[model samples]
Target: MENSLEFAQQLDRTDPLQSFRKRFYIPERNGKPLIYFCGNSLGLQPQTARLALDQELVIWQQHGVEGWFEGENPWLSIHQRCKKPLAQIAGANPSEVCPMNNLTVNLHLLLTSFYQPTPNRSRILTIGGDFPSDQYALESHIRNRGLNPDETLLEVFPRPNEHTWRTEDILTAIEQHQNSLALVLMSGLHYYTGQVFDMAAIAQKAHEIGVPVGFDLAHAVGNVPLKLHDWGVDFAFWCSYKYLNSGPGGVSGVFIHEKHHGSNLPRLAGWWGYDEARRFEMTKGFVPMPGADGWQLSTPPVLAMAVHEAALAITAEAGMEELRRKSELLTGFLADGLQETATVEIITPPNTAERGCQLSLRIKTGGKTVFNHLTGQGIIGDWREPDCIRLAPVPLYNTFEEVWRVGQAFADFTS
Candidate 1:
């Protein structure tokens, strides 16, 4: 693809999803809209979000205590309503998915049930440089079980000098450690370098040795095509605030394979997860609702779920198949535009299959200066510490021309 405004505009004109750009509020500078390439961090606010949230507020104002049962969309079963779209996004059956607490909280809860250390098999196999919350949660859980973190957590690092991991290295780690591994939990997609791990391969290797496997899909859910159920992932979790565009601190959820729904796998139970038919009975014993709904720790936040429902509907309407097709083209065009810039190094994997919307650039010199200049020119991308700038041209609202302008902004940077 040529790096020219005419070419970029032509691509936008022919894009089937071009009209979708009007559905969200694009951030602006001065009077015009800025180039927004930060959807991997937080998505743009959907126009429907305001109306959805206001509906819940009105329910609260009118019915107060009875809102859970009274409104057109009752709060009592709001979590259930989200199941279908969430399942579609997660690539799991509705029975296996449920929206609940935030990411870290769900991480802790899932680890409690999944990380069962024994005398012979008592270690966890994971990747180095996963999201910090996953690292801390694993460490705390290891310590809680009277084991040392350094001994129980085996992290597979990148080979020698590489930004992204090799699938073979990870597979070997799991195979070598399988004898002593009780759980294998890792990020489906790397946060910093924008690498998509070979999750299907990783899960297959772990399960071959009878080890329980899971993934932190915080970056993978809406950004890529996932078949968590077909791939036999034991469990997975993610946040909706990013590509899902539910809003900041939006509700999080989990996918528990249906096989475990009937089994007595341990879980940290709460009142909200109680068996629905007998919930109001207020019985003493905790009988969990069947399937992934059993993982809920508290009442689902209606306001947050309302916004989530509206945003998720848009994703459902577009469908992941179509979204992924456009995403690859957009990122490929961005990659080609910057391939010749002397000061920039593309650290993210070049293969379309190994990445989604994000492309992390390690600027060789004056990285922050370059980032600031881009900002001044109405190019909005985020700066990671020391030397990287992240630009994610989200397929939902971002356009071909905006990505083209970013390349122009770089060429015009004096440094």
Candidate 2:
């Protein structure tokens, strides 16, 4: 307690955005603040979220039917209004983006539009350790096409002595399977290991081989700078709960490069994707909106959109370049501190450019013991299945002092 209090004092002295901490609801036990380091999972709620949501609630109560058209935030163009700032974060044009369903659902929708398997080339390639949701989506998509996953789905893995696959190895896998690849799908940043993959290089190589490339940016969207359209990625999807600081199960987004916007692509049709000009004409068939907005399947969730809009405004306000600057400094500070702890090894790559706000620490000894110790002491970081602890110092809300404190907590646990 003494050490934690002293660390808190030090943090208070040096934190640049420390005032931002008060903008969130901090979980507590017995009237003390519990240290939160799980922004990589679900970010703390923003203070503005409630106000944004309530603004709509008031409209709903005062003018039930009119609110849909005349509300302060009109339900009609609500989704459209969110695109510009989100596009800024995604490195895309407004027309190339849309906020729709959850991450997995959006991935499935994108596959329907982009993953058209031909007789000779019907396989989808993914990384070996992709998130389970993505794995299942890929397997199901292949099976639905009357293709066997065992034969059609290829997985690229790390070499014999490595815990993480190198960029070169992944590119080699793409080359080896190029002849039969219908699509090359990958996570922009790995979930478990916290390694940011080289999206530009991977996309370029896959395109060279005549295979379309897509990505699940659930961990990368707000954590790193992306040049999605410039990289020539066919499509991408991301959830907003993590680094973007929208609440749990908040809205997710998708991107479709402009090149495919006018193509005669087949997509799962829904009323939401119908052209807005004639949407209320009681049309019998779907008329798709151009660009990524064509993928929408249902009415937009206004409350969720409000929460995301608030967060996106904050992200655009802070600017990715600035957030990334703080992120590199804060994560590197944690990495440096862990090295001196003498009982932990960082599994994630050491290069700041190769990662985001997270550091995956493998405790050589007292793994769970250290995890539990931190928990008991009111320091909260997440632990993966067996031995790794994931610490994310979100640039918007986390401070360098917190990084040092978490480090000392590890030292105390090791001792």
lDDT of 2 by residue, 1-415 (tens): 1234465467556656567666777778899977788888998888999998998888788888787799456888888888999999999999999999999999899989889999999988899989999999999999999989999989998888776779999899889888888999989999888999999999999999998899999999889999998999889999999988888999999999999999988899898898988989977988998888988999999889888888888888877897898788778778877776777889888998889988888877778888999899888889997889998888888777777778888877776
The reply for model 1, stretches above 4 Å from the true place, is none
lDDT of 1 by residue, 1-415 (tens): 8888999999999998888889999988778998989998999999999999898898899899799999677899898889999899889999999999999999999998889999999999999988899999999999999999999999999978788999999999988988899999999988889899888999899999999899999988889999999999999999999999999999998999998999888889999999998999998989999999988878888899999999999988888987898999999999988877999989999999999999999999899899999988888889998899999999989999988888878877743
Q: What is the C-alpha local distance difference test score of each model?
A: 0.91, 0.87
Give the least accurate 10-residue stretch of model 1, judged by summed lDDT.
Answer: 406-415
Candidate 2: how large is its RMSD?
2.5
| Full-model lDDT, candidate 1 | 0.91
Clashing pairs in 1: none
Q: Spell out the clash pairs found in candidate 2.
A: none
TM-score of each: 0.99, 0.95
Score residue 385 of candidate 1 by CA lDDT. Answer: 88
Which candidate number has the best TM-score? 1
